[model samples]
Target: MALNLNDLGIFVQAVEHGSFAAAGRRLGMPKSTISKRVAELEAMLGARLIHRTSRSFSLTDVGRDFFEHARASIIEAENAETIVRTRLGEPSGTVRLTTSVPTAQFTLAPLLDRLAARYPKLLLSLHVTDRFVDIVQEGFDIAIRSHQQPLPDSALVQRRMAAHDFYIVAAPSYLDRYGRPEKPADLAGHNAIVANAAETSWRLLAADGTLQRALVNPVMAADEPFVLLRAASSGIGITVLPTSVCATAVIDGTLERVLPEWTAGQITTTILMPHRRGQLPAVRAVVDFLLEHADAQSGVLNSLANA
Candidate 1:
């Protein structure tokens, strides 16, 4: 049966206000009309809700139980309305974000600081990992990732934030001791810090549209770039890394670009959301802020790509 919410609301108000006349005054209706609606509600449920009397108002055993549940529904409805109204204004509320470790460290996390300053009521929760996550299943409002190939197929709205390529970089001390590679062929003799233990081949693109390949001796290996980056900065060996991961170290002179004239491959930074339509204001605001600063976030690549 289709429940009459209006009748349910009137019934609850009648019990709370303690009299039909009082419920009518609060709801702006006649006492008889309020009493009739409550009666209709009781009849629809096939139960006695109120025991009406001239001197007092009372409830049946079933009526008391129903009243408790009905009042909760009314409060929830009011709160839902309040949330909608809040969203229409300042984009207030918590936005749950998930991102890869590198992007979170170098790109998205910094942009959120600016977002927080702009929207004081906005809150952010960040989850960082290297694995691909199911944003919908994981209850994330937004996701950011940097990748070399296309992201896996999904319904999420994917926006490319920035694009950059990998550069060979190492500490100045490493190059000073072992000397720097002046050409692709020179890498064959260099000690390389690689992502894995297996022998790795690097395909570099030269300045004049020539593709060159070289193999380097792997002195150390790690699956995570941050670890490899730290090793590279300690003068361990040359490593291929995207500029975003190494930009701060490079800027601070902890790491120096090697074979600056060649790029290994390109990578894209992208933002994903479960859906663009019907996103809460807070989620939308964060997405806009990310897209706005996407370039500035990756500007390190452009600055040093030619340097």
Candidate 2:
């Protein structure tokens, strides 16, 4: 006997509500209808799924196993429906997204504020983290990453959003004390404030499109970008970072761009999804918004890049 989705749905609901009557109430169906569907489901499976007494109900061993699979199937079905509804209907829903802490605070968060004001029905959940997150397993609808490489293959559909350049920046006080380097090799003597030990190496592009790499040991090292920025703002040392990361500080004259000639390799921002077909309405909206936001800020970014 083939299992009916309706029957399995009823059985799952009955287990969730802990009683046929409660399930009926939740599903807006009669108690008899709920009970009958659950019975039909058990008959189709040739197993007793529920043990019912006067005032309560409990799942049998077989039911417990069935329930797990049933629940997952139901959720996938619901997610499929949501995806269809989002594509066909008004773009209104909550999109759960994540990004690195510094980028979220300085870049994406402000963009989200604009999006929220424009689309009142859209709910945005932003999770800021430095550690890697499994977007699909963690139930995130979208994730924004800023790096040259694409997301690792598993279930994710990665889209290249925008590309921006990085820069070597330092405070005016620091420049006054140590002086700015005219070339990449001059950075060897500088006390660089590095965000990560892994980031101790910097990549630059030569005039002929060649890659120039440099390794500079920092006198001050920090795990957090914001912490390193603060240290840099205090005239600590020169740091190589994305232009957007130091945009506000550079604009406000707290930090100044150093090594205007040596160019850092372009960094690309990417939008990640579990699958194209599984995208929710809010997720699509946010992704679109980010692209537009990047375009709008391109002039300022271009200046920073060329600086």
Candidate 3:
């Protein structure tokens, strides 16, 4: 029996939307028509795909398995279309990207806007969170992350974008109330706003290649870097933060660097791609745009360091 792709698509849509009526509303078709098409699809497959009721609907075991394959098929079909369009010099597809919230706010938001302006046909879906996301499992095409340690071995391809320098900073009021730390060990006496309460210790690299670890007494702790920056800016305590996040405040004198002779540590910013083979044109375009911008930013940083 030949199965209709339209019927299969309707069935998948019904499953995704959780009801025939919802899928009909989304697809702008009559609910009865949607229901009939799904029934026809199930008949062609010779299996009961969904368990239907007057009030609700659910998928059977076979339906659940079929849904997974059907979803993959739809994605492959869309990708194939996109590939063909790309070959004709028109790149149009959705690119799902994930990154840290701070990076999303401070760095990526404008770049994405520029990308949208450049590629009017491209669609971008961005996921911003603090937790580590599994790009492959989550079906994300790209991910940008900052890591202090080397990334774990994985099949994903990684490209180093830039190195993020960290600084220990405090509001001038806090530094006035509590004398600024002259050295890394002096940090133990001052209040600290840290990312992790359990791991309040920070390793600092000195100017002369010396390493110092300081265990701080946490006055405030939060997982997000922006929260730490807020607390430190509010005169709550000294906190370590990425220079990119605190540069404006530092330049404006709202925050002063503590122990300017040392750094908290450097985290490498990297962009990860799932695979090189069969990459979507949209994905390749975004990757190249980001790399170009990152290189430009790195050159500015180099010039500043030299000056």
Candidate 4:
């Protein structure tokens, strides 16, 4: 017997909507028609797909399995149609994305505005948090992250956006009172406002290419970078921060780079997607936008560094 895509879709819809009546309402078909199509599908497969009552229904074991595959097939078909439609100049879909809070605030907000202006039909659902989110399990189409450590091997496609350098900073008042450090070793005696308690050391590279680690005395520690930034700015102690987050503060004279000659470390910014194949046009558009904006920001940073 030949399998019918339409019947499969109807059966899946019935399963999803919980009954033929609800599925019929959603699909703009009569309840009787919905029931008949599902029944036809079960007959073709030679299995009882659903256990029905006068007022309710439930999927049989075979129906539950079939529903999963049928739902996927329907989605694939819709995505295929969307690909053609997008090529013809109409890209419309919701793209769910996840990223760190700091990146969202300091980097992605303006870029998202630009994306909205360019793709009026494309909608974005963005989740911003400090915790690492599982994009696949969370139903996210894309994720952006900044990490100093190497990422583990994964099936997801990874794209490097930029490298962010870390800067150790202190309020001018704190420096005047505690005395400025002439070398990394001097940091050992000073009160430190660390982002992580476990990270009580700052690694620095010297002009002669020598590397050194300075163990800090932490008076305050927090997981959030903004909290550390605020603590450092309030003269609680010296703290390390990403250059991107500290750039404006440095310019505004709220904080100054402590060891202007050295960096703590470099964090790589990366974007990830589930797969390269069958990527929706909306997803592709946002990814390209992010890469372009990241490159432009990197150029600006490089120019500032030279100056």
lDDT of each: 0.81, 0.77, 0.81, 0.82
Residue 42 displacement in candidate 3 (angstroms): 16
Candidate 4, residues 25-93, lDDT tens digits: the string is 656799999989887877878899899999768888987888888878888987888778867885677
Best by lDDT: 4
lDDT of 4: 0.82
TM-score attained by model 3: 0.68
Give me the displacement of residue 305 in model 2, in angstroms: 2.5
- Higher-scoring candidate on TM-score, 2 or 4: 4
Q: Please say which candidate is ahead in TM-score: 2 or 3.
A: 2
List runs of model 1 lying over 4 Å from the truth. Answer: 1-89, 276-278
TM-score of each: 0.70, 0.69, 0.68, 0.73
Candidate 3 per-residue C-alpha lDDT over 1-307 given as tens digits, one digit per residue, 9 for 90 to 100: 7777777778877876678887786577999999899888887888999999997698999999999988777767767877678778756667889999888876687587778888888888898888988765455789999888999888888888888678899999999998978878899999989897787789998878999889898877898877888899999999998866776677678888888878888878889987732266788888888889888766764553333
Q: How close is candidate 2 to the true structure, as a TM-score?
A: 0.69
